[model samples]
Target: MNIIETSQLTKYYGKNRGIINVNLKITEGEVFGFIGPNGAGKSTTIRTLLNFIHPTSGIAKIFGMDCTKESESIKKEIGYLPAEINYYDDMTVSDLLEYSSKFYEGDFDARTKELCNIFEVEKNKKIEELSSGNKKKTALVQALLHRPKLLILDEPTNGLDPLMQQKFFEVLKNENKNGTTIFFSSHILSEVQKMCSKVAIIREGKILKIETIDNLRASNYKKVTVEFDSAEMADEYKAEGMTSKKTRGSQAYFLYRGPVEKLVASLYRVKIKNLNIQEPELEEIFMHYYAKEEE
Candidate 1:
């Protein structure tokens, strides 16, 4: 089943566009990546999905329920970690977590304790006294306390140290193993590449591409760097499917997305001093989409 689905999902802020005709289908137990930089409508889409803000047009559904009309019910089975966390400053971490637990059914005390322990949250410390990283740890504990069916995380590793970040992803992997669908939103391509099986790349409020990580990598996009015998040779060399081309003196770098033999045939004509061809990283692939959009 599609754990999350959106159909032509759109949002606007007065006259400004937030997301336009954004569609997504995430099946149960999938670790889906929603990738985009800041101001790329990642947060707006998340807020819309949570019904924290109503969509200007289209529809969003979670677990087959309307996001707007059935948000209360939908939220019950979802855990959310917003990009920015805000809690009652005067309350202790323990107190805040206790208050949050009152909204959900069942005994979550044991779960809360376990999460706090795992995240190293200081229960007695006031929220105001916590550092940014500690605050994030507290939020992590709160979000995972109930062990919801779906996890919606937005820039979840922002303030975490390297050790904590490792721990965080490990925890997420375990959650996915237990059949909890994860919606990981971030601008960090490496993080998405590490955790997600499939990813949707968004820019300027539109989804540019959606594909499995393996398929994306296997899309025949190659990062080719060629060093010619002279600057003139570097400048004159060109081939089909070459894009985002740049040349400096005797070196030329470009992304090629065509048959390797064709690229080899093209290169055979040039006085190539050295050549390097490798699969483009997710970041590079992401930039290729942005470049296309801009063009």
Candidate 2:
């Protein structure tokens, strides 16, 4: 089932384009990644879906219900963790959590306790007193406490330390195992690469591509670094897929995406001190997409 779907979903802020003719379909029980740098319409798209803002022209649906018209009913099944959170400053963590729980139907005490324990959130601390990391932790706990069917997270790990980030991911994995569909949005490629099965790349208010993580990783790009005994030898070797080239002294660095045998055969002529060939990271692969668009 498609948990979420959008068709020609466009949003505008006066003359500024937020998202133009954007389309997306996310299946139930899948971890979907929405990735782009800041000011790339990721947040705008999300906000429109949540009915926090209206789309200028287009249709968005959650569970097959119109987003704008059925948002009140839709929100009951969603747990959202915005990129920035602002709880009542004077309230303790526990108090804020308890207040949030009242809107939902079931008891959240046990789940809240479990989440707090996992995140090590200090429930006694006032919202104003907690550090950024701790505030993030609180927000995460609140989102998961409802045990909602879908989780919409925007830059969810912004302030977490490494250990806490790991713990949070583990929690997400567990939730996915239990059939919670997650919509994870962030510019951090590594984290998305680690957790999501499929990802959609968006830039400049447009979605460039959507593919499974494995397919994306296997999509032809290779990171190659070559070192030469002489600068002349390094300069002589070239291939069709070679791009983003860089030269420093006697070493050359670039990306290659064609047959490895052809590259090796070409490299045989060069007097090289060392050679390294490996798959490029998601960030590099992402840049390749943008580069293609610019051309």
Candidate 3:
């Protein structure tokens, strides 16, 4: 089942474009990644899906209900953590959480306590007195407290330290294990690579590509680095399908997407000191997409 779907979903802010012809279908129980740099419309797409903002054109549905028409009903099943959080300043963390809980019907005390303990949120502190990280923790706890079936997280780990980030990821993994559908949006490639099975890359308010992580890594792209015996050898060597190539002193680095034998044959004639070849990271693959767009 598609837990979330959008068709030609476009949004504009006055004369500026927000997202154009954006289409997505996220399946149930999948950790779907929405990735793009700032101003690429990641947030706009998310806000549209949540019906926090109305789309100028196109359709968006969550769990088979119209986003704009059925937003209040849909929101009951969604736990959202926005990139920027706003809470009543004078309210204590516990008080704010309690207030949030009232919107839904359930006994969330156990879940709320579990999330607070995991994130180390200070429940007694007023929203105004908490550090940025602490405030983020409190927001996280509030988001997860209701045990909603869908989690829409935008830059969810922004204020967390390394340890807390790891804890957060672990919690997300557990949530996914329990069949929660997660829509994770961020510019951080590494975290997306870690948590998502499939990702959609958006640029300039348009989706450039959507592919599974394994398929993307297995797309025959390899990160190759060679240390030649001399700078002349490094400068002179070139292989088929080499891109983003660079040479520094006696070392050359590039991405190769052709036959490995062809690359090895090209290297055989060169006096190479050392050679390293590995699968390209998600960031490298992501940059390749943008570079292609520019070209």
Q: Report the Cα lDDT for candidate 3.
A: 0.90
lDDT of 1 by residue, 198-240 (tens): 9999888999989898876566488899999999988988898
TM-scores of all candidate predictions against the true structure: 0.82, 0.87, 0.85
- Residue-by-residue lDDT tens digits, candidate 3, 4-67: 9999999999999999999999999999999888899999999999887999999999999999
Worst 10 residues of 2 by lDDT: 278-287
Q: Residue 223: error of model 3 in Å?
A: 5.7
Best TM-score among the predictions, by candidate number:
2
Model 2 agreement with the true structure over 1-295: per-residue lDDT tens digits:
8999999999999999999988999999999999988898999999999999999999999989999999988989899999998989989999999998888999989999999999999999999999989999999998999998999999999999999999999999999999999999999876888899999988889999988988776665788999989887777667878888888888999988878998888888767789999766656666788777789
Ranking by TM-score: 2, 3, 1
Q: Select the stronger candidate by TM-score from 2 and 3.
A: 2
Cα lDDT of all candidates, in order? 0.91, 0.91, 0.90
What are the root-mean-square deviations of the candidates from the true structure over C-alphas? 4.4, 3.3, 3.6
